[model samples]
Target: MSLLDVHRSIVVIIDLQGKLMDMIYRPNLVISSTIRLMKLADLFEVPVVITEQYPKGLGSTHPQVLSVYEKLTTKKFYMEKDSFGCCEDQFYSILKNARPDTNKQQIIIAGIEAHVCVMQTVIELQENGYEAHVCWECVSGRGEEYRDHALQRMNQKGAIITNHESVGFEWARDKNHPKFKEMSRLFREGQITS
Candidate 1:
């Protein structure tokens, strides 16, 4: 499938909560990438789903990231899931409801504790017939080692590993396209500049 085919894809932001965010290494980077991803989703009119893993115990999603969602004009499905992999009943229901009736079977995912929630969800998505692609730099754990290991394991399990910019460009596909100029400007001048 094409990168810009994200219009048919869903963007899942998994478990990027308050308590977890505090413990993650490079939380700022993940948060920033998430915001960028969300912005791109809005620009492209892609569906977005966000999960908070037991928000009461873990606190809410980080304030900064949460604020971005509030500003989005696009439809967003928000859920509090106790399951690590968001492929559980509630989340899957949301996914089914939000899914565009098209050939885009891809799911672009990013979130915290890569080895746990992110890894599990990506695997489940693949098993369930969705093309799962994880944005590497947009996911992290409490330590660099843990993050590295999770990424390695996810790659081994057949997830398409990529970075945030790569995802954005893939969605844009062509420099001369209308959305291309806007997407490029947002990437080059927005908070996600790498």
Candidate 2:
């Protein structure tokens, strides 16, 4: 219930794997928004943790996403999980520690399957006392109904339902905070996809 602080934020990119990515309702939008979020995270010096659900089956994170991630010099980690909810995964504790500041309690999530993984992760993070900010356009399910309802459900449960642009400006907090130009370019690149 607060404006996101860059020092308190950690970007968690979840389950944008191949087979699964292709199944989402708006995979391109998810990819585009996620890419932007990743860039913002790096530019703002926020840490990031990426999760792939059973890469052996789902394929690794999408190539476009991986490319952005690969170029990030900020604190980062890539973990593969069997658990739908990231908190349930074995690497949960380590992922929490991945950020330079253990005080980074705000979870900025962008990924696929809004109804399952994204929903469970947001709810669980809140239950555990972390402020979860879900990037709306950066997540989606196999069907529009499922995706829409899941987002509504998360909002009802106290998760801050937000978009990628809001996150960047919130993190920057002011026009002179630095990195605004690069952040603006990412936004202008278009978060929407055909």
- Model 2 segments beyond 4 Å from truth? 100-104
TM-score of model number 2:
0.94
Q: How well does model 2 score by local distance difference test? A: 0.86
Which lDDT tens digits does candidate 2 get at residues 73-149? 98888788888888875556755576535653888988878888999999998888889999989888899999899
Global lDDT of each model?
Answer: 0.83, 0.86
| Residue 179, model 2, lDDT | 89
Candidate 1 — what's its lDDT?
A: 0.83
What local lDDT score does residue 126 receive in model 1, on the 0 to 100 scale?
79
Candidate 1, 46-155: lDDT as tens digits: 78888999998998888888899888888799999888888888887888777747544788898988989999998888777778888887899989999899888877
Off by over 4 Å in 1: 1-4, 190-194
What is the lDDT for 103 in model 1? 48
